[model samples]
Target: MDPGQGKKAVLNRSCRTNTSFLSFLCVYTIMKWALLSVWDKTGIVDLAQALIQHNFSIMSSGGTGTALAGAGIPFTEVSRYTGFPEMMDGRVKTLHPKVHGGLLGRRQIDDAIMAKYGINRIGLLVVNLYPFERMSRESLPLEKLIEYIDVGGPAMIRAAAKNFKDVAVVVDPSDYPEVVKTLSSNVGFSHEQRLIFAKKAFARTAAYDAAISNHLSNLDNTFPPILTLQFTNGRMLRYGENPHQQAAVYGTTGIAGAEPLQGKQMSYNNYLDVNAGTALLAEFEEPTAVIVKHNNPCGVSVGTDILEAYLSARDVDPVSAYGSVVSLNREVDKKLAEAIDSTFVEVVAAPSFTRDAVEAMRKKENMRVLILPERNTSDEVRTIDGGVLVQRTPAYQENWQVITDRDPTTDEMSALRIAWKVCKHTKSNTIIFADQKRTLGIGAGQMSRVDSAKIAIEKACAPLAGSAVASDAFLPFPDTLEVAAKAGATALVQPGGSIRDDEVIKAANRLNVAMVFTGVRYFRH
Candidate 1:
């Protein structure tokens, strides 16, 4: 096998059987031996201690080995076991004979693999992949992204996972305590337990591989289907959208386990509403806040600060804000916390929160505070009746195009672009009211465009007197634009290809409102 093309791997035949459930954790009292190599070390120290307590010998590579040594815990270095020092800018570790053979070999000595590589033992492998997703999302240069791919880690995990009967693999930190419990119950975890873990290991590896493929491949490469179909063993809600339906809360990659810091056990519909609110709020850069009800935003606002934004959005329609799922682009602060605490909000999602803010929120015994590790609006997905709707993302892409007979003035052009961007994010039959680089109001999903315009006006009741308006599609009639002008909108934006483009433009001219035609239509449906 060529080193340049990745090492060839072989697995010994299965020769082990499983044990019946001993306890919630099939505690194995003894550990024979193990190998560990990881990138993120969340509970590695405790895990290593647990293995040591069980009388297991350890072999590790690089920083992990060094860490164990610093703690006065003895370990066989990967170099000492494989007889090959980690080289190539520290890229070639644990890729040699002894490592793979041990994980992939059955207890009964197999001559085929040994004859090819002269190798023998790894009973268990604990590996967590390099931070590829974290690296890709960073504001890093190309070189950093190149350094994050884990070559040896995934390969070894796959090899051990393929020979599951002979190996125990742990890819997630959360699995450590359970693994330790099972090991302690029985002298050793049986073949079945290992096999179950092996399946999970392979799935984890597949997810990592798919993320890499999608990130590297360009649009024209005809990318493969890669959406995370992850749903951890979270709580089953009382019911779904209504008592007549059924539903469950499914989480995505990186985020695991449902731990609502403050709230009653979340109902299925509550989770859905919270997810929609948080996802929509994440779309803007400003100190934006969104309140969602039944997968639609009842109110949204952007301001220089979070408190003002949340208050403005909340004040839009207090009647609708009741039990609303609220989300903010910025950290939840004291003022915002106080405002939220004084209400009947069901959930509050934000990137983070101050200590005082959290304490304030705790006053509401049933309000949930979800701290989103990362603001994730770059990519999105949704499933429909026939199939899923996939795209680069519908995430408010900046508009740089202009289509109008008379060129808009510089100020009008900037406002048009901003308003257009916000309108694109609002639901179809959309109308967005904007001024001063912030969204004043948004009306979405109306049957008639005129009604949508009216909703936007109603939402921005006070500010409606002097803001600009944006529409996702052509009005097809003059009435809509005339209403927008009547609402004191200073400018208008639409796709502008309707046969009655003349009528719309005429209304714009009559109202002295600067107008633009994007030529591209953006319908959320």
Candidate 2:
């Protein structure tokens, strides 16, 4: 026998001996290809190294490829593998059929077609979109901002996610360790794991698109034709407003997104009260403290210092301040922390807490302590029967005018301003009675304006004889104004829009009550 013929005969005999072994070899090789193209290069190098250790080949492009090469990791550039040069400033690299076909191709059903097209099956995909949301907030021009909107990344992620049964997709770098762990497992990624990753991947793309849509629409109109909102970083609560309901909190910034630095988990009621308190606290730049209960401002005050503010606020309605969420605009010191901890507070939030202050708070381990940042307001949204309600207020100053014959005194004016700010955050029909430093009494969420005024007078811990009264809306009749005046309120503030405004003003003049009419109404239902 010839030498070459003998070698060929041996190869043919080995192939015929085990057809199952040949099929297994082919399947194993196809399942070891991973494509990683990410805007955030976090943990990519370590993931590539782990994949290499597990005998998987990596394909990458753009910044990801550059990162892998810098790390000395062997990877096939997407441009090289797809036989297509990355054009359009590296935007057209991964949008090719080869990359998507590899991600979307089925294992068994499309095996023949895939072989014919020379498309490799991508068993794993790791991709993250560009920083469109981050850049949209900058002062960049529209053209420059548009460049950060990624095209191919979302496409590949969607394709891989759609075929999650056969392809594993990862959009978050935080999941790299889990992916690596799964690769080392005997069974690899389970079906449940794949499904979870797929769901997260789809959500990521949806949120990215929503951000882009909202930013573009907001450029032209305050309210877009279609409104889109995306809330992430969710935390499950024990229960909602009531024990029978379910609830969760989702946000990335502001009070909605804040987590406790020390203490018990935040409940649904705790979150509502904290959110309300923080919004009210943001109104005063002075050392201010706000305490909220049942989504209403039970006590709010401004003072020369935080300790003084907190003491005045707490004393305004000490009974109602129990188990309330307290928010302070200034840092909490040891003395203020001790004062706050003396009560059964549910949550305490401040811009910062001194080391001694935090240590003092440790005595109340069950009270949540949050480092509250500057509160930012956006368009408010609420749910209705079948749809949602969106409300946006244009930036404007209040048009305040003296509606009564006698103008309010300087002290009364200062107190009226505080009352108006508190009234804007309170529930209507609401009445707020305040002195120069703190709220004396608050009546909120009442059905009748007269009843709210009566309740405010009845609940005052301090004297109402020299306090300023604030009504959230225009009094339809003079009955509410008369009630406030009869309760010893020296001055009053309300939006003057009712048809009986003249009658109310006359009643105020007759009762010797100083009244101011702010053109803007603050009905916070």
| Backbone clash numbers for all candidates listed | 13, 0
- lDDT string for model 2 (83-128, tens) is 8999988879988888889989887888767766667788899998
Q: What is the lDDT of residue 465 in candidate 1?
A: 59
lDDT digits (tens) for residues 1-525 of candidate 1:
111111112111111123343221212222256788888888887888888777667888788877777777767777865778889988898887677787777654564455456454567789999898788878577677878989999999999998887788999998899878976886677878888889889888887887777777733464455544443465566788788887666555322344567777777767667666666665577788888876677777777788888887887667778988887878887878999988898888887889999888888988888766453344456789977776674434334444435556666665566577667656789988776555667788999999998888887736665677889998899898888888888778888789988877777777777787767787876
Q: How does candidate 1 fare on TM-score?
A: 0.69
How well does candidate 2 match the true structure, expressed as C-alpha RMSD?
4.5
Model 1 global lDDT (CA atoms, 0 to 1)? 0.73
Question: What TM-score should be assigned to candidate 2?
Answer: 0.92
Q: TM-score for each prediction?
A: 0.69, 0.92
